[model samples]
Target: MFPRTLLCLAVFSASTPLLADTVWLKNGDKLSGTITVFDGGKLLIQTKYAGAVAIDWKEVKTLDSDQHLLVKQDAYAGEVSKSLTAADDGKVTLANGEAPKTVELASIQQILKPKPIVTDLVWKGNVDLALDYQRAEKDTDDYDVAFKTSARHGRWRHTGEGEYNREVQDAETTTNNWRAEYSLDRFLTDQWFWQGRINYKRDHIEELARQRVVGTGPGYQFWDDELGAFSLGSLLNRTDYEYRDGSKDNFYSVAMKWDYNRYLIGKKVEFFTNGEVGKPLSGVADYALDAELGLRYKVTDWASLNLKAERDIISGTNDADLNKTRYTAGFGVAW
Candidate 1:
């Protein structure tokens, strides 16, 4: 009877279900699995619905019962009101309310959504072509083309962009302008990054000949990983330009940019503003300043359109700085 009792006890212990604290080991490798049985240091792991795996006790170093659970959460929490009802003619009428608002669905050219999948490391390229017809104090018509590309790997990022412009007026000689810039950025942390850039510019005016400038700068980035991202940065740049008459001037400037994203015109819109203050190192230009504002809409996964306006508020040392404004509208594509 004593032998029988001992046998029964051993059998019961071997058949008992192991708790979450149990660990399994096999061939010097330790693993955590739902344990089904333990007998004299041998472990039986319940690997899903597929039978049990036997492991030796000597192979396990330790067992961890705690497991991490990852839960996905939505980021957008705001509610959109759909109080307007569409009519048969495609016009929308607002429901009776204290502040009634109505919109025309037919007038909506496109609908855009925020792209959460676009990150800093996606290989992409874009080109923009625009024709600007402007009648300033002086009549000016210009054609512009811009191209940009970006690539990233781990913590390093590279970007390059260039622009070409041609302007014609009835009285003034045709002017040709071109600018190119390249930049590299390195991420130091989730929120902090640093960048270095080089820029070159050339302007040609008939007999007045040509002018050229080159500049370089280093800047910092404050970034957030979320929709409607924002970044603020400042740059210190030095520019040297040569004129048609064999004259040259050197200038220094500090520039800052602010960027934001929002919903506009039934589409996602990106906006940015930039300002710069420049001082001359030599020549006739003592100080110069400029400001620019831009907006873009994503038309598709690989296409977008943008509009920009810029003002040159200051120009030279002797003459009062003349205000020059430029407007551009262009389309961009990415791959």
Candidate 2:
């Protein structure tokens, strides 16, 4: 009888160690699985019954993780990183000590599980093309092309985007403007980051040959969730402008940028808006404004419908405008 009891104890301990994570929902549904991500807005899980499933993070009322997780904190929680195990009633338990501390779940911005080596970095983005032509009358032609991509690995992120627009009427060039920019962000905390950016632009109609801006500064993310996101930052940029008239100017400028995006239809439709104000410390072009407002609709897994209106303004420059606006609509392919 003693030998049989020892065998039963060994079997129970081995099986219990193999048990997966557990998530209890508000509606009394329980899921036994592994948690891939819990971003408060979205939750990803893997289970034997469903293979892989995603659920609204808000619907999860309680969760128990057997593995250690790196947790991001909100401002109210002192912005400290914590290792966590279980969450209950909007409170998460620390895993480090025998006497565990609890943190408010609302103050937890991100909960990261251990990732494998193959998934250390991830990338995604889109490319768009638009063309127009009218050959019968005065031989009118127009074309617009844009591409954007972003990558994330650990606490570092990178983004690159560029666009070109051109129009011709009666064989005369009326509009020619293009800009390319790249940015890098390093996370200092859950809500704050250090950022660096560089940009190059050219506008023929504005009688500008080329303009380049390079800068680095700190940035803050006010809010980021499934519904919407917003961020604002300021940078000191070294700018150089070359005009078609062979005049060249260079200066240091302070630039403020605000960007926001919102989802209207749960990954089907979304809105994006961004604006920038740049003031030169010493140059002919005193200040410049650049902004974009757009919407993107997911048509398929790899294709999306896009509509955008852009505005550019330059004050105290060679050729300034009260407001210059251009509208574009097209389909974009993404991967």
Candidate 3:
């Protein structure tokens, strides 16, 4: 009888999934799973029986976990890494080394898996391409390719973006231009940073054949999380322009730049916009704007369809005034 009991116990243990985390719901239901993340008022968990599920944060009554998690509390700027010990209803104890502290679960704003080390690198980026061709009244070919990437480690962040565009009509190149920009940022605080950037643009058909800019400024990071991020910067720039006729002009300018993106509908769709507007300090040009806005519908984890509109304007330049806008649609991969 003892041997039979041991065999039954072993079989039961083998059939049950091993879950290190558990949450007790307000309605008296309990669930065993691995916490994926808690963000935007939703707690996501992965369970063997039900796959991944999202529960309203308000529905969580108590929780315990053996994993190291980063818990951000309300009214607190920094994150805490500690074990979660179940306490009273709607509360948990943080095993904060020597002193264990209990806090209301409602006061927790965000929960995530803690990185192994502070200095570990985090990287994310995407590339997109659009192409068009026609064989009607006038043979035409168009191509647009753009890419943006960023990487961060410790207190430093690096960002870069570039685009190439070309169009041909009747076997003649009508539009050809390419631009690239790179920026480096050093964080002074969680939401504040200093940035230095350089940009270059070249056009094969336009009167303004070459453009170069260098800038330095301070930027504010509103927020960066699993869902989205936004940032704004003010820059003092020195811009140089060279025309197709070989005339060159340079001037200093002040500019405001913004980058924003948000994920919606369970992160299946994304809306983004980034742009810069500048006024020359010396009247080199009345104003200049370079901007793009886009929407991406994620088809899969790493694949998406994108539509974008871009605008470039240089009003009242000494040699030539410029205004151009373009629209594109394409499919791309992301990571």
Cα TM-score per model? 0.51, 0.71, 0.77
Output the number of the lDDT-best candidate.
3
Residue-level lDDT of model 2, residues 1-335, one tens digit each, is 99999999999898885768887777888888887665536777788887656677667676777666656564222222234456667676766666677777666656665345523344667798777788986898888899988776557879899999999999899898899999998878767888999999988777667889999899998876545678898899998878878887788999999888887754678798887898888756767999989998988757988898888877787543335888888888976
Give one digit per residue, the lDDT tens place, for model 3 in 244-263.
99999999999999999998
Backbone clashes in model 2, listed as residue pairs:
none
TM-score, structure 1 vs. true:
0.51
**Model 2 misplacement above 4 A:** 1-24, 30-37, 44-58, 61-122, 318-323
Model 3 C-alpha lDDT versus the unseen true structure: 0.88
Which stretch of 10 consecutive residues in model 1 shows the poorest summed lDDT? 69-78
Backbone clashes (count) for model 3: 0
Q: Write the per-residue lDDT of candidate 1 for residues 1-335, one digit (tens) a residue.
A: 99999999999999997644334233444444554332223444656544455555445433433222111111212112223333433343444447534444333221112123422134556687888677888887878887767775446778787778788896565757677777777766544567677767665752223323334444444442212345554566666556666655556655554433433543356565544556655555656655667787878746888898867554663423345677889887645
Candidate 3 residue runs with Cα over 4 Å from true position:
1-120
Q: After superposition, how far is residue 118 of candidate 1 from its true place, in Å?
A: 16
Better of 1 and 3 by TM-score: 3
* Candidate 1 off by > 4 Å: 1-120, 132-141, 170-173, 206-218, 224-228, 251-267, 279-286, 317-323
In order, what is each prediction's RMSD in angstroms? 23.3, 7.7, 4.9
Q: Give every collision pair in model 1.
A: none
